[model samples]
Target: MCYYLKLKYFTLHGPLPGMPPQFLLGNLAQSGLLFDKASLPEAHIAFKQRYGDIYQFWISSTRLIVVNNLNDIQYIFTHRNIYDQGDIYVQKFSIVIPHGLISSKGAKYKRHAGLTLPLFRRGKIVSNFDLIVDCVDKLLIRWRAKSPQHLHLDIVQQSQNLLLAIFGLIGFDYDMETLDNDNDTNKNELTKALQYFLSNFNIMLFSPKILSTIYFKLSSQYRQSQKTIEQYFDRMIKQELDNGEELIAQRKRTSLIASLVGSLQQDEEMEINKSEEDRKGLSRNELLDEMRLFLLAGFETTSTALAWFIHLMSKHPQVQQNIKTELSNNNSQGLLSLDQLDSLVYLDCVIKEVFRFCPPINGTVRTLTVDDRLPETGAQLFRGDQILIPFHSLARDTRYWSIDPELFYPERFLGADKDHHPYALIPFGGGHRQCTGQDLARFELKVIAARLMQYVTFGDGGNQVNSGGHLSKLTIIPKHVGVTIDFDK
Candidate 1:
């Protein structure tokens, strides 16, 4: 223990502050801070109260500096070149998405990111508006079938199926009949695989190599589920390769898979003259990795956000009524267009507030590249040390917003908190590494929220069912999101 303390002192700044009487396990028990599988944000909040904005903790030999201050986070993220997604993320996510953009670095990252950027641009996203509406209409039809009963619905399950259907049609040009049929074998298998992976990911990533190997061998279900999910993606990639070009030319901007294929082909042509090391473009396996990533990320995060939004709306019925009024006032004809979706300003505020209040992802981690001192505290950071920018903490910090940050207030965006610090509310994150699909995510939320408000009234399922607490999966999910849906006549 003395030796460990001395080593920590020599490597990091002396006795780096935070909760004292360090746990015997050296914060490995608190690894949830990184993955956020528990109430890690609350723990971080407590740490901030005790130790100010910047503090250090250890997860085995690894040292993490948690930065809860807005200014510090802004500086760190803005200076993107100095930091890269940490090895912890790469090691864990690579198990599921080996060569995907999220896990790749350097020239490969640049190539993939460059190719993918065009597909997610604002205009390109807007062009898929019809596809989104079509998918949402199907969902509404499903809800209508359950209408007049005022059914107590599982918002999480409903949202997941809805987004999965949308992602299937728009993302891959594949029809995942998740909405029409509840027992989609492939969908259930994939969801199970994702859940198992997320639940066990941190342990596998952070454990010693030998122990991790043993654990992997012992967890046969996890291994099989991973293989099953990968095989499914492989099949999808093969289908795309076979038909993507013709489909792309016909549907143009509507199919994300088509765009990805087009980009891959363009890269292949560009790489023809280059040496092996100089070559850039996705191989079949690489494409499979990216497709799986898109499928999971496209649906999982958005559905979780929608679930949280529904739960919040149920809790605050007045807010729900206001959104319905806004939708009705904006589109009197009862049919929504992309232009009209954009015009529903209060709904936009509600969406923004939902993102701010219950961000699906708690935060992301970056690894330091060189020795540096924090601008605010002059705290020293050595190369390879991990920096954690807690997004939840910054958004909820009392010092940054004019209004109380804890309250579930959508009007804050429209009023006093309108001009809060730019970095204070980074729900999708900030700088170069921020989520590229944010526009698509936001657009999806608006369309769904608008459509739902137009057709159904979500009533509170009472304290037993709607009581707010989060389940920290790969994203922060609303644990108890039961709502009573009253479909309009």
Candidate 2:
């Protein structure tokens, strides 16, 4: 099928099935369906029902293809050499995190991934197990201080505070006293900067480039916010370099920043041995960009996942009892070891279910490098055409899953969907460009869930407050995450 545009005299391939036109604004007015702060996932589902798995729409003059099939998504992600990160993401995120792995492409992305991958390896992450456990324990202590009369808690806010402390301790060697000393002005400033950047990120990403530029020029608050965030990153990067030099002198590499700095130095030495043309080390500004990306991505996704886990547990008391039973059976006690945490088999299933049910990211985008035909439909794709792999749609598609995808059943992993298609449940994406910190994220989730289950029970805070809807932004966040916490006697 093809769509002919009267104004441009151009031919476009594939189905064009959506709401009626708005003259010059072809789907731009209805852009709220896909890009709105709320109801993004629902809009995708509605579009899929009208059009097939693969459909085309216009965002102004640029054409966008939404690919919802598992096979197509797998093919695109696996062929990382053929396609690169979409221009939208590079253009939107580069201003804040220029050379970070998420925005960088080609050799730069490979270099950043190589330098940062080791820090998230199983052994390295498990080495920091005690630190993560201590953070969880501190959170639990705060909960213990609360009145035991089924106190209502905002899991979203609480989880954010807990993960910020963990990220501060592990990502950087600095202490963020947001969890303990609320009066700490430095920590408050840092937290506010991060929150401000994240809350407004989608606005910057979706607005037209010209409009955003003009707004930034006129809005002093936006400019000042960006300056504050950059200043904080600069100070943190300088501290990391100073500490990294001392650690290198002692021949000990502990933090992620130290490892990155050491790798950069090695690259410099190698470059000196070779010609100047072969230089590959990251510059100081590049290092700062990556550090900012790590801090933001690390804390935001994990904390959101934890909030969902807690909210789900509150509704499903049986799942909580099952996790507690698994903990008891595994003989967990006194700061559980990594092995003990891993042994909580039922809890693992529950975590997987939570990820499938409420993914942190809704989808990822890719820009075509050359003219190509989609393998499944044989549709023509031009160079520079943008493709979206809707993660939420694939995970919940009934065609790909054996059990009913709508139900919140953790047992599906143990039985019906044990050997499901790999791409059908990719919460962290796939192929070379997948999240580098997935191992660390999973370990943190398991440890926090286990620790929380050991000390307390979560109950639903009634339908009015606990009704689950998503607030779409940089991430798909739960609209309401209020829960009642009951301490274990």
Candidate 3:
């Protein structure tokens, strides 16, 4: 049966090179992925080295074509209609946020994107700059209270707190109070529920894809977390409805949740006989999922990126000093305007390098819609086949960089490696399905980092704790981020 299945699925792609799979388990057991023995990103790097660019990876009977060539990646991302959303992407995210934009495609995706994308545009995000700074100040205050004697801190948790507070306010006009309330018991019930959901979801990353549905069904904690999350969304929706029309209209400018609620109400008022294709707004369940997606994606990716930035800064004091120099050179006084934030050129390079060095997402997957051939690699692909485009691999590949890709230097962006291929350093995946909240994420990160630079300098706690390694969750975050925070007088 295994041989027959292999002949049927794998052979049709024309004997693509990859590690031989174990019977029944496929490559899961041999790849050390099933038991958490290897990091998936590193494993992809190893496979690319061994198989040369394009290779096949199997999770049980499921097959994935992992591609490392820039041209192939560019072609796949650019031609979104042909590749759509990958099976793996839709499969994994659908389990968590089935109705959200990340898991959707075609007409449903058009509806969700139409309703929500405008709220995350650059103009709307820039308008909320002060709100972001205010949230960061609350975090700074919390950290200041732990000064001198207790300055050593795990930035993973600290970054999480800061981002949770920021997203809670800007995303929904709700305050998580994660910074003010340190004790888990004292956290808002919604915050606690979100924490619980994410913790369990992280565990799901290690488990096999086939077991995800069964695991969610059997896990009582998972069910309870879902219930609590739903309850929170219910209240938010009711509050939005109670505000009537005027408040919702005003909130559409600043609050993503308010905008979504307005869209939902619009859907309700749509003509009943209209075709599904003509419908634009989301249903209530979808509204809940979109809210959950905003909460989950908003905080999770930005927090992880901030943790990476902090970890990188602690290791490279020179880079930190450079950023400080840039800030001082600009005579940045008090909170910076959006134009002022954009003026910090060196700081911009450092942030870009942080993303390249360690993308929050390891890779993005895209599934083929019709039979096609890769433009550069000449690899034949079948309809419904999924491909993995590893961001870490692309960033680290020496072939694509004029400078040593292994080095953690930010200056490469300004000098010899300047004008690198556009697709070479995509922390956020590209093309039509690119991350909607990316503008907001980048703006928030710049504001927070800039604020931190003004008031404090991060020092390496020591080799034992500060030496960089990553922990893979929904996003990749530092495994150990103990660092000393010295307050500037």
**How many clashes (backbone N, Cα, C below 3 Å) per candidate?**
0, 0, 1
Clashing residue pairs in candidate 2 are none
**Against the true structure, what is each candidate's TM-score?**
0.88, 0.89, 0.94
For candidate 3, write residues 196-272 as lDDT tens digits. 88877654554455687788888898898899989988998899899989988998887788888898845455633
lDDT of 2 by residue, 131-203 (tens): 9889988887777777666545567777888888898878776566767844446566767766666666765
Off by over 4 Å in 1: 1-13, 20-38, 58-62, 147-153, 184-218, 244-252, 265-277
356-473: candidate 1 lDDT, tens digit per residue: 8888887878888888777876777888878888778887899999999899999998999998899888888888878877888888888888878887777888788788787666
Better of 2 and 3 by lDDT: 3
Distance from true location, Cα of 68 in model 3, Å:
1.0
Q: What CA RMSD would candidate 1 show?
A: 3.7
In model 1, residue pairs whose N, Cα or C atoms come closer than 3 Å (at least 3 residues apart or on different chains), thus clashing, are none
Model 3, C-alpha of 489: deviation from truth (Å)? 2.6
* Shift of residue 260 alpha carbon in model 2, Å: 2.6
